[model samples]
Each structure stands twice: as C-alpha cells, then as structure tokens.
Target chain A: MILTVTLNTALDLTYRVPALTPHTTHRVTDVVERPGGKGLNVARVLAALGHETVVTGFAGGPTGEVLRALLTPLPVRDALVPTAGATRRTVAVADRATGDTTQFNEPGPHICPAEWAAFLDSYETLLGQADAVALCGSLPPGIHVGAYAELIRRSRAAGVPVLLDTSGEPLRRGIAARPDLIKPNADELAQLTGAREPLRATRDARRRGAHAVAASLGADGVLAATPDGTWQATPPAPVRGNPTGAGDSAVAGLLSGLVEDLPWPQRLARAVALATATVLAPAAGEFDAGAYEELLPRVQVATA
Target chain B: MILTVTLNTALDLTYRVPALTPHTTHRVTDVVERPGGKGLNVARVLAALGHETVVTGFAGGPTGEVLRALLTPLPVRDALVPTAGATRRTVAVADRATGDTTQFNEPGPHICPAEWAAFLDSYETLLGQADAVALCGSLPPGIHVGAYAELIRRSRAAGVPVLLDTSGEPLRRGIAARPDLIKPNADELAQLTGAREPLRATRDARRRGAHAVAASLGADGVLAATPDGTWQATPPAPVRGNPTGAGDSAVAGLLSGLVEDLPWPQRLARAVALATATVLAPAAGEFDAGAYEELLPRVQVATA
Candidate 1:
C-alpha cells in the first residue's frame, strides 16, 4: 500500500454564490466540503486508480473530525494523528455568474512539541508497512523545516522508496536526504536551483541529493532527469480547467508507475495523462475516469 | 433563566486579512470562531451581563461540534438538538486595510420533520423553566416559514414572555402570534409595516399583534411603542466601532429589563445604552461594560 502524509490537513469548503463582490454580503446557495491537503489529494486519486492508499497526518479538533468523516466514505485508510489545535478550513467561493473562484485559506492549528513527537512515532510505524511513501504539502507551524528530511531518512531506514513533493526549505532539506524522487513545478524548481531553464534546474535538484527529479511544466507536462536517463512528456494539447489538484494527480500517477515497475517514459506518459485528465475534472483532486482512459495512450514521452 | 432559540445556528468564522480582492486568494492572518445566530448573539450578551441563559437550536454535524466547543466556555446552557445534516458556517472576511467586511453565509442545514419535532419537544421543556424566550434567526430549509409563530405560541402557552427577532415572512407570521415584544431594525420595520417612519412602523407592527414593538434605529438608538407608553431613547452621541451585534445587545438589554420589571422608559434607556456600548466594542456580541455603565444614565428616553 502507498502511504501519503499531509501534515497540514484542511476541511476544504466550497461555497457557491450567484456573484462575488468585495465588502458585500453573499448568500451561499450551496456548500460542499471534503478532506484536503496535497497528500490526501494524491491518496484520493490513487484510490480512484484502484491503488490501496493510507493517509496519515495531523487531523485534530472539529475541522479534523469533519475531514475524517468525509474521508470515511472513500476507499483510503485513515491513520491521522490527533492534535490539540483544531484543523483549519479553506473556503473557496465559486461565483456562478462569472465562473470565478476566490479562495481563503486559514493557517492550520499549531502543533505542539509533544504532538510532533507523537506524529513522528505514528508516521514511522506507517512507513514501515508501506511499499512507497509520498510526503506532500506545506509543513504546518511548529514543525521544523527539516521535518521532511527526517521523514525521508526514516523511510530510507524502513527500506521504502520515498517521493518528496514540496517547495521552499522543506523541499531543499528533504532533497538532502536523497529521496528516490522529487517533483517540483517550474517556479519551485527555479526558486530551489535558481536555474531559468527546466532542464538545468532538474539536474541541479538531482545533484542536491535526489536520485531523480521530475519537473512539472504545467501545460507542457512532466520532465524527468533520472539516474537512468532524461525524458520529457507532453500532453496531446493544452487542457483548460481548474488546475487545483492536477499536480497531486500527476504525483499519484508517478508513484503508481514506480510501484508497478513501469519504465521512466511510460511513467512520465501516465503522469502527463493524469494531470491533463485532472485539469478537465470539475473539482480539485478528482479526475474523470473516461478522460484518463482516453488520454493515457495519447501522451508523448521522448528522450531529451 | 432566559431561553434563546436559534433555529438556524452557525459557526461564525472571522477571517482577518490585509486586504480583499475578488477572484484572488487570501491568507487569513487570524481566525476567530464562535457559536452565532441572532439568539446566540443575544444569549452571549445576556451571559456577559450575568444572566443565566439557555441556548437551544439545531446543532449537528462537525461545524455544530465546533460551535458547541466554543460555547462550552460561555455561561449559556447548551440544549441543541441533533440533526442529520451538518451545521452551516458564516464567514466574515475583515479587511484590515480598509476596515471593510465581506460576508459569506452558508444556507443552514435542512431540518427534517423528525428533527423539527425533536426541537419542539426540547423547546417546550426549556420553556417550562424560562422566564422569557427569544426566538431568533431565519428558519432553515425543510422547516416551515411559520416556525417562529409556532414557537412563540408555545412560549405563551408555557406562560413565558417571548421576544420575536427576525425579518420577512417569518417575522410577519410570528408577529401574528402576539409575541410579548418584536424588535425590527429600520429596514425590517419598513418591510413589515410599509412605513418609513419609525413611530408609524412601530405602531403598525404592534397593530399586527405584537404586544409591544421596539424599533432599532441604528445610531439613533431604540424607539419603543408599548402598552405603557411610546418612548424614543436616544444616545448621548452616536457610538461607532463594529455594529455587528449591537442589535443583539439591545435585545438582551430589553429582555433583562423585562425580567427585572423595569418601566418601559427605563428599559428603552437600558437597551439604547447597551446597543451604543456594543457598537463601541471591538468584536460582535461584546459590549464595553464601562461604556455601558457610563452611557446608561446619559441616555435620554422621553415620551413621544
């Protein structure tokens, strides 16, 4: 089973309004809530793809309870640790008139030292039974920047392949632990390696310690610089839709391919296909099965 | 004990941001949540005034749990009924830069017939011990528009004074039940009575079956048309801060005076003073005690 960790879980709330105006009152016609965070999103897409996935993270307080309740219906297993601070909520206001969305993200609850220690213990245990682990999303407050690095080291000790997907200091620190793979979008890759070019940035990122670097070029798709070789995957055409959870879907695709022993080219092809499919989906973290099936064979991956 | 019924209770979330722009993302700097609705707001103000208050409403799902947890520290007794649907949330985005607020209010959970019956049963039991009951807020979906009318009748049957605080159809139907008092702001009064003048609107409202009518004239204070006499209470000067809960504080003041058997003029003065004090407070449902005390004697309530 693939294990995904989301330290900063959120109760994602979507409010549908007729219109959105600043400094005015809006009566939301509908509300939809779901469990959210990068890893959870990845787990959801993996579960949809018939992969067994376990989600572990800090889910506490009332929002955590709501998130857990929403997760109960999903196929993924829940191993979320309880914390003192209530989980945060992210509100996305969808304007029905203009088809625009305004998002308000609340900083998650602060995790105390004891809570972090407890999470470490729980995470280590989950890592031991996992075939592969994906560390996702931003580190919540009270967690050190080296948290991903510590987790990557623990995963290495457990003899499991680890995929680190994050940005800024966490990504930089986690890469130093030499995780099997790291997925950084164009901006994050540039910020980390200060390389204006994706190819150079991917190589710089790998030199920092990662065995492989996958750079997502948005509409262009995935570019991988692995120990085996370098390959660039491109979609059939640009897919325009809400791109909120497209990257998470790509990570799930890559992780699924890794566990299935697919070649780097085939994996990149699947990642690109899934990312495009996710972009076509109505909401974040969800992809249309038909779209994924249709686009799977159409993606092109070539040696760079 | 005073019983406050908030049929449509909400988890009131306040998000503080530097500025607000439509269709963009906002990182909320601070989050403050409290159990809220018209009745809950009134109950909070009453609790602060050292009154023994009981709050009853439909509070179910995770947001309800969060609202309940927040209410635990307050002096009000929780007698909320459980429902199948999750409670709603009302988000207020306070722009620190412009001092403007954008509000998004979720339509509350649908209350099925069984849930409504359960709430009524609970309400009657509470009314047996209540000296006065305030029926507040809108009716959630699946509940009848005459809900307040039914509740007001029940409170009268139990020999308890009832204050109906709402607007539109529910308020119109509730007034027909001859509630002990009805407090309508300028807009709501004009909507209900079709009278632009406060005195004419208050008189029309009382004729519609409310035993007494109290009109909140915003910064001008409260005007009361009661069985005793008609009086207009004006503050020393217009107090300004957050007027979110100023009306609720006025309701609390009126209820407190009613229970204490204060004369109509004294009650109007107290309500006006408390309303002004609440406007000076930093947050909703909170009043400056010092300001309330200082303004009480200074408020002018003359026969009109």
Candidate 2:
C-alpha cells in the first residue's frame, strides 16, 4: 500500500460568482468542496489508478471533520491524527464572466509539540507497512522545517522509498535527507538550486541529495535526471486548462511506475502523460481515464 | 426569556487581508468567526444587555457544530434543532488598506420537511415560556416562504409578543399576520410598502396589520409608528462605522423596551441609541457599553 502524508490538509471550497469585484457583495451561485492538500490529491489520483493508498496527517476541528467526511467516499484510507486547532479552508472565488479566480488561503492549524510527536509516532507505524511514501504539501505552523527530512530518514531506515514534494526551506532540508525521488516544478527547482536551466536545476537538485529529480516544465512537460541517465518527456501537444492538480497526478504516475519496476524513461513518459490528462479534467487532481489512456501512447521520452 | 429564531443560521467568517484585488491570491492575516444570522445577532445583543435569550433554528453538519461551539461562550441559550444539511458560511474579506469589505454569502443548508416540522414544534414550546419572540433572517431552501407568517400566528396563539425582522415577500406576509412589531430598514420598508419615505412606509406597513412599525432610516435613526402614537428618534449625530449588526442591536433595544413596557417614544430612542453604539463598535453584533450609555441620554425622540 502507498502512504501519502499531507501535513497541512485543507477543506477546499470553490465559490462561483457572476463576477468578483474588490469591494462588493457576491451571492455565490455555486459551492463545491473537496478534501485537499498535495498528498491528499496524490492519494486521490493513486486511488483512481486502483492503488491502495493510506493518507496520514493532522485532521482536527470542524473543518477537519468535514474533510474527513469528504474523504469517506473516496477509496483512500484515512490515518489522520487529531489536533486541537481546526484545519484550514482555502477559498477560491471564480468569476463566471471573466473566468478569473481569486484565492484566499488560510494558514493551516498550528500543530502543538505533543501533536507533532504523536504524528511522528503514527507516521513511523504507517511507514512500517508502506512500500513507498509520498510526503507532500507545506508544513503547518509549529512544525519544524526539518519535518520532511526526519520523515525521509525514517522511511529510508524502514527500507521504504520516499518521494518528497515541497518547496522552500522544507524542500531544501528534506533534499539533504536523500529521498529516493523529488518532483519540483520549474520555479521550485530554480529556487532551490538557483539554476535557470531546467536540466541543470534538476541535476543540481539531484547532486544536493535527491536520488532522482523530475522537474516539471509546465506545458512543455518534464525533465528527469536519475541514477541511470537524464531524459526529457514531452506531451504530444500542449494541454491548456486548469493546472491545479497536474503535478499530483504526475507524482501518482511516477509512484505507480516505480512500484511496477518500470524504466526511468517509461516512468517519465507516464508521469508527463498523466499530468497533461489531469489538466484536461474539469477539476484539479481528477484526470479523465479515457484522456489518460489516449495520451499514454502519444507521450515521447528521449535522452537529454 | 426572549426567543430569537434564525431560520437560516450561518457561521460568519471574517478574514483580514492586506488588500483585495480581483484574480489575485490573498494570504488572510487574521480570521474571526461568530454564530451569525439576524436572530443570532439579536440574541447576542440581548444577552449582552442582561436579557435571558434563547436561540432556536437549524444547526447541523460540521459548520453547525462550529457555530454551536462558538455559541457556548456566549450567554444565549442554544435550542437549535438538528438538520441533515450543514449550515452555510458567510465570508467577509476585509481589506486592511481601504477598510472595504467584500462579502460572499453561501446559500444556507436545505431544511428537510421533517426538520421544519421539528423546528415548529420546538418554537411553539419555547414560545409558551417566552416574553417575546423575534423571527429573523431568510428562510433556508426547502422551507416555506410563509414560514414567518406561520411563526407569527403561532406566537400569537401562545399569547407571546413576536417581532418580525426581514425583507421582501416574507416581511409582507408576516406583516399581514399582524406581528406585534416589525422592523424594516429603509430599503426593506420601501420594498414592502412601495413608499420611499420612512414615515409613509412605516404607516403603510402598520396599515398592513403590523401592530407597530419601526423603520430604520440608516444614519438618520429610527421612525416608529405604534398603536399609542407616532414618533421619530434620531441619534445625537450621524454615527459613521461598520453598520453590519446595527439592525440587530436595534432589535435587541426594541425587545428590551417592549418587555419593560416602555412607551413608543422611549423604545424608539433606545433602539436608535443602541444601533448607533453598535456602529461605533469594532465588530458586528458587539456594542461599546460606554458609548451606548453616553448616547442614550443624548438621543432625541419627538412626535412625528
């Protein structure tokens, strides 16, 4: 079973308004809510791919309860620890006329020292039974920046491969723990390694400690640098749509391939195809199965 | 004890952002939540004034649980009935730079027929021991538009004085039921009576069967027409501030005066004073007691 960790889970609320004006009242015509956070998104995509996935994180307060309830119908297993503070809610107000969205992200609940210790205990237990673990999303307040690093070390010690997906200091710190795989979008890759070139950044990231690095180049596709060799995977054509959960889909593809013992190039091709398909889906983190199947054969991977 | 009915209760969330712009992401600097609805606001103010107030309406789902938890700290007694759907949330994003607010109100939870019936039974039981009942806010979906009318009749049958505070057709229907008192702001009164002038609209609303009509004229204060006489109560000066819960404060004043058997002019003066004081307070539904006390003696009430 795959284990995904979302340290800062959220109750994602999307509100559709006729138009969003800076200082006016909007009667939200529609509201759609989903359990959200990077790892949860990855878990959802993995579950859709028929993978057994368990999600572990802090889920507390009313928002946490709502998030848990939303997760109930999904195939992903919930292994969330309860915290005192309520889980955060991210509100996205979409303008129906302009097709523009204004986002308000609440800082997630503060995890107390004891809660963090409890989570470490729970995560270690989950790691024991996991084939692979994906650590995703931002560290909630009160969590140390070395959180992902600690998790990676523990997963490595448990003889389980760990995939790290985060940005800024946490990603930098976690990279030093030498996770088996790391996926960073172009910007995050550049920020971490200070390399403007995608291939160079991916290589620098790998040199820093990651065993492998997959750098997402948005519509251009992905640049992967691994122990075997470096490869570039490009989609048949640029897929234009909401790119919200495309990265998570890519992560799901890579994890599935890794567990299946596919070659690096084949894994890179699958990741690029799945991400492009995700962009074509109506909502984030959800990909059309037909689109994924059709795009799979069209993805081209070549050594860089 | 005063009973306040919030047919459509909400979890009012206030988010503070540095600035508000369309199609931009905002990191909310602060969040404040309170139990909200017209009736809940009234109950809060009534409780602050040392009145024993009971709040009843639909409180369900996770949001309702949060609202109930919030209510636990307040003096108002919670007698809310459970519903299948979760209570809605109203988000107010306040721009710190401009002090302008952008509001997004979610359509409240759908109330099933069984839930409505349960609420009616609960309301009738509470009315039996109430000095006065205030029917406030919009009816949630699945509830009849004539809900206030039915509630007014029931309160009358129980010999409990009922105050109706709402707008549009619900206000018109409830007025026709001959509620003991009806408070309509300038727009609501105009909508109900088709009269732009406050005094004219108040008189027309009274003619429609409201025993008393209290018209809130925004900065100009309240104009009241009662069975005893007609009076206009004006604040010392136009109070300028957030007017979010000013109306609810006025309702609290009116209810307090009614139970104390104060004359129409005195009740109008108290209502006007409390509303102005609420405007000066930092948050909605909260009044500066010092300001209320200082303004009470200065409020001018004259025969209309």
Candidate 3:
C-alpha cells in the first residue's frame, strides 16, 4: 500500500457567481465541496488508478468531520489524527462572466504538541505497512519547520522509498534527508535552486541532496534529473481545463510508477500523461481516465 | 416568550484579507463565524436584551451542527428542526486595503415536504407558548412562496402577534395576511408600494394589510405608520461601522419593546437607537450595549 501524508488538510469549497464585482453582493449559483490537501488529492488519484492507498494526517472539528465523511465512500483508507482546532476552508469563487477564479485560502489549524506526537506514531505505523510514502503540502501552524525532514529520515530508517512534494523551507529541509524522489513545479524549483532554466534547476535541486528531481513545467511537461541520466518528457499537446490538481496527479503517477517498478522513461511518461489529463478534466484536480489512457502513448520522452 | 423563525438559516463566515483582486489568490488573515439568518440575528439581540426568546428554524448536516453548537452558549433557546440537507454558508470577504466587503450568499438547503411538515408541527407547538412571532428572511428552495403567509395566519389563529420581515414575493404574499407589524427598509418599501416617498410608501404598505409599517431610512431614521398615527424617529447622528446586522437589531428592539408594552414612540426610539448602535459596533450585526444606552435618550421621535 502507498502512504501519503497531508499535515494541513482542508475542506475546499467552490462558489459560482454570475459575475464578480468588488464590494458587491453575489448570489452564488452553485457550491461544490471536496476533501482537499495535496496528499489527499494524490491519494484520490492513486485510488482511482486501482492502487491501494492509505492517507494519514490531522483532522478535527466540524470541518474535519465533513472531510472525513466525504472520504468514507472513496477507496483511500483514512488514518487522520484528531486535533482540537478545526480544519480550514479554502473558497474559490468562479466568475461566470469573465471565466476567472478568485481564491481565498484560510490558514490551517494549529497542531498541538500532543497531536503532533500522535501523528508521528501513526505515520511510523503506516510506514511499516507501506512500500513507498509521499509527504505532501504545507506544514500547519505549531508544527516544526523540519517536520518533513524528520519524516523522510524515519522513512529511510524503515527501508522504504519516500517522495517529497512540498515548497519553501519544508521542501528545502526535507530534500537534505535524501528522499528517493522530489517533485517540484517550475516556480517551486526556481525558489529552491535559484535557477531560471528547468533542466538547470532540476540538476541544482538534485545536487542539494535529492536522489532524483522531477520538475514539472506546467504545459511544457516534465524535466527529470536522476542518478541514471536526464530526460525530458513532453505532452503531445497542452490541455485546457483547471490546473489545480495537476501537480498532485503527477505526484500520484510518479509514486505509483515507483512502486510498480516501471522504467524511468515509462514513469516519466505516466507522470506527464496524468498531469495533462488532470488539466483536461472538468472537475478541479480530477483526471479524465480516457484522456490519460490516450495521452500515455503520445507522451514523448527524450534525453535532455 | 418571543419566537423567531428563520426558514433559511446560515453559517455566516467572515474572512479578512489584505486586499481583494479579481482572478488572484488571497490569504485570509482572519476568520470569524456566527449563526446567521435575519431571524437568528434578531433572536440574538433579543436574548442579549434579556428577553425570553426562542429561535425555531431548519438546521442540518455539518454546518447546521456548527451553528447549533455556536447557539449553545447564548441565552436564547433553540427549537430548530433538523433536515437531511446541509445548511448553506454565506461568506463575507472583508478587504482591509479598501475596507470594503464582498459577499457570496449560497442558496439554502432544499427543505423536503416531510421536513416542512415537521417544522410546521414544531412552530405550532412553540407558538402556543409565545407572546409574539417574527417570521424573517428568505424562503429556502422547495418551500412554497406562501410559507410565511401560512405561518402568519397560523400565528393569528393561535392568538400570537406576528411580525413579517422579508422582501420580494414572500413579502408581497405575507403582507396580504395582515401581519400585526411589518418592517421594510427604504428600498423594500419602495419596491412593495412603488412610492419613493417614505411616508407615502409606509402608508401604502399599511393599506396593503400590515397593521403597522416601520420603514428604515438608513442614516435618516425610521418612518412609521401605525393605527394610532404617523410618526418619524431620527437618530442624533450617523455612526460609521458595518451595517450588515443593523436591521436585525432594529427588529429585536421593536419586538422586545412590544412584549414590554412600551408606547409606539418609545418602541420606535428603542428600535432606532439599537439600529444605530449596531452600526457603531465593530463586529458585524452586533450592537454595542454602551452605545445603545447612550443613544436611546438622544433619539428623537415626533408626530409626522
């Protein structure tokens, strides 16, 4: 089973309005909610792909209860610890007239010391049954900055392959623990390595301590720098749709590929296909399976 | 005991951000939530004023649970009926840079026939022990447009005075039921009576079957047309703050004064003072008790 961790889970709400005008009242025509967090999204896609996955993190209060209830029907196993503070909500207002979205992200709930300790125990137990682990998303309030690094170290101690997909300080520290793989988007890659070019940034990222680095360049495709060699996997064409969950889909593809022992190029192909298909999917962060299947063989992988 | 009915209750969420920009992401710096619906707001103020208040409405799902939990610490008694559908949420985004608020109001949960029948049973039981009933706010989906009219007629049959506060078709149909009192803001009055002149519109509203009409004229004060005569109540000066809950506070004052047997002029004065104090209060829709007391004696009421 694949294990994923989302420290700062959220109840994502999407509101559709006729139009968006500043300082005016809007009658939201529709509202859609989903259990959200980078790891949760990854686990969802993984489960859809017929993979056995388990998700662990912190969830609490009314919002947390709703998120858990939403996950009950999904195939992913829930191992979330209960916290005293309520989980946060992220509102995305979609304007029908302009076809644009305005996002308001609330900060995550504060994790108490006891909750963090409880999560650590749960993660260790889950890792024991996991073939590979993915640590995803931002660290919630009251959690130490080096949380991902500690988790990576623990995964390595247990002789399990781990993938780190996060940004900023957490990503920087976690990479030093030598995770099996790291996936960073173009922006996250630049922030980590201070390089403008994708290939250069991916190489610089690997030098910082990642065993391999896959830099997702949104539309352009994936740039992978690994111990074996460097390869660039490009989608056949760009797909038009919401790109909210594309990166998480790529992470899911990569983790599933790693566990399945697919070749480097084949894994890169799957990752690119899943990311592209997610963008084409009508719902936010969900992939179109038919599109994924069709795009898989079309993805071109060549030496960088 | 005073009974207030909120057919379409909500979990009102306020998010504070540095600024609001179209098609961009914002980090909400602060979040605050309260049980909301026009009737709920009125009940809150009435309870704060030491009135024996009972609030009945429909609440269900997770958001409803949260709203009920929030109502637990208040002095008011909860008589809300449960439904299968989840309660709606209204998000108010306050932009600090412009000090402006943008609102997104979600449509309320669809009340099934069984649920509406259950609510009727509950409302009838509560009305038997009530001195007055206030039917406030919009009708949720699946509820007939004449729901308020039916409720008003039932209140009359039970020998309980009923006050109606709503807008559009619901107000139009409810007025024909001859509620003891109706409170309409300037715009609502104009829409109902097709008269831009406040006094004329108020009189016209009374002719349409409301025994008494109190038209709130924003900063100017209130124009009242009752069986006794015509009267105008004006505040000393306009206080600047959030006006979101000012109307509900006015409703509370009017209802409390009615139960206490205050004279028409005194009730108008109390309503105007409470409305003004709510505007002066820092929190949305909550009145400052100190300001209410200070402004009460200063409110001027005279024969129109």
Task: Write down the TM-score for model 2.
Answer: 0.95
True contacts kept of each: 0.93, 0.89, 0.99
Cα lDDT tens digits for candidate 2, A129-153: 8989999989999999999999999
Per residue, candidate 1 scores C-alpha lDDT tens digits across A174-249 of: 9999999999999999999999799999999999999999999999899999989999999999877888889999
Which prediction has more favorable TM-score, 1 or 3?
3
> How far off is model 2, as Cα RMSD?
2.0
Residue-level lDDT of model 3, residues A34-59, one tens digit each, is 99999999999999988999999999
Give all TM-scores, in the order shown: 0.95, 0.95, 0.98
- Two-chain DockQ for each candidate model: 0.80, 0.79, 0.92
**Model 3 reaches what TM-score against the true structure?**
0.98
* Residue A27 alpha-carbon offset, candidate 2, angstroms: 2.3
Residue A278 CA displacement from its true place in model 2, Å:
1.8
lDDT of 1 by residue, B40-139 (tens): 9999889888899999999988788878888899889999999988788899999997668899999999999999999989898898899999988888
The total number of steric clashes, by the backbone 3 Å criterion, in model 3 comes to: 0
